[model samples]
Target: MNIHLRLLLLAGAAIFFGYTLYYIRKKQLDLYHSIRWFVLSALILAMALFPELLTVLAHVAGIEIPSNLVFLIMIVYLMLTCLSLSASVSRQHARIRTLVQEAALMEKRICELERRIKASEENDDDIVAREAYKDKSR
Candidate 1:
């Protein structure tokens, strides 16, 4: 491994690992989501420490270039991550829809109850006036 490449990988891994920890601590990122980034940073550190591993993996995978393999792995990871995010968003959409429906139903029930109460009060007032008028006439 060239000294420059090793240094770059080490720095990148350190930065990524630190940012992941910071976000998790601040509650800005969920632990579940951060786990992937942590693993990625660890892999980067491993590659920096042992660049030979990449060559071996490339040979085993029948790839001509190790760098291409790394890029391929990154693309695959990103695609899978995107799929996971899409599913999560879909689930939240469903939950929001359910909550909105429930709220609308609750509002409708409240309005109906209020209307019924108002009608009942009006009927009581009318009955009271009729009774008072009859007593006066008698």
Candidate 2:
């Protein structure tokens, strides 16, 4: 690789290593997210490091020589990242729905118990009234 490419590769490696160390120390980001960040960063940096390859790819895709290859690659990379994020969001949404259903069911059970207690209290009052009437009759 050329001197500039070598420098870019070194920078990419440094980012990956530094980020890994930071994550290990902080325990903030998940493995998947970190890996994704590493891969995307490397892809972008590598592309910058090798502009000629991009020119050739753009040509194959019928894009003009001076076309916006960088933009095209960025668009594709963004699409992939969005897809992954969408899947993660969908899973979390399903989990939230399940939790909501469980909470609703528990609330319903509590209401049912409250109603039963009220009914029992009413029955007890009726019994007391009847007993008082019998005592008066006696």
Candidate 3:
């Protein structure tokens, strides 16, 4: 890689590392989720520090273009990240469905109890009225 590209990559990696740490400290990102980002930043730093590593890896993998190899790695990383996010979203959806169902059931139960209490109160009022009527007749 060119000197300028290396420097840029180093700066970008450092910034990403700092931002990842900040997010973790602020509780904006889950620790588990941040792990991948940390690893990615570290990988970027390593690549920036040692551009020859990519060349060697590309040659070993039979890849002609080092830049294309970098792109391939990035594409794989993105796909994995997407898969992780999709799984998380699906899990959240299932949890939300369960919570909603539980809430609906609780609400139904509450309404049923409220109706029973109201009926009981009405019966008590009727008994009081009957007692008063008897006393007046006497």
Better of 1 and 2 by lDDT: 1
Q: Compared with the true structure, what per-residue lDDT tens digits does model 1 show for residues 23-81?
A: 99899999989998998899888878987898899899999877777677778877998
By TM-score, the candidates rank as 3, 1, 2
Clashing pairs in 1: none
Model 2, C-alpha of 86: deviation from truth (Å): 2.4
Worst 10 residues of 3 by lDDT: 65-74
What's the TM-score of every candidate structure?
Answer: 0.83, 0.57, 0.87
Global lDDT of each candidate: 0.90, 0.78, 0.90
Better of 2 and 3 by TM-score: 3
Q: What TM-score number comes out for model 2?
A: 0.57
**lDDT score, candidate 3, position 53:** 97
Clashes of each: 0, 0, 0
Off by over 4 Å in 3: none
RMSD of candidates 1 onward, in order: 2.2, 5.2, 1.8
lDDT of 3 by residue, 1-138 (tens): 678777987897899899999999999999999999999899888888888999999999999977677778878988999999999999999999999999999999999999999999999999999999999999
Where does candidate 2 stray beyond 4 Å? 1-25, 107-138
Candidate 2 structure quality by residue, lDDT tens digits, 6-102? 4765576578667766985698888767887677667767666676787788888888852366567768878998998999999999999999999
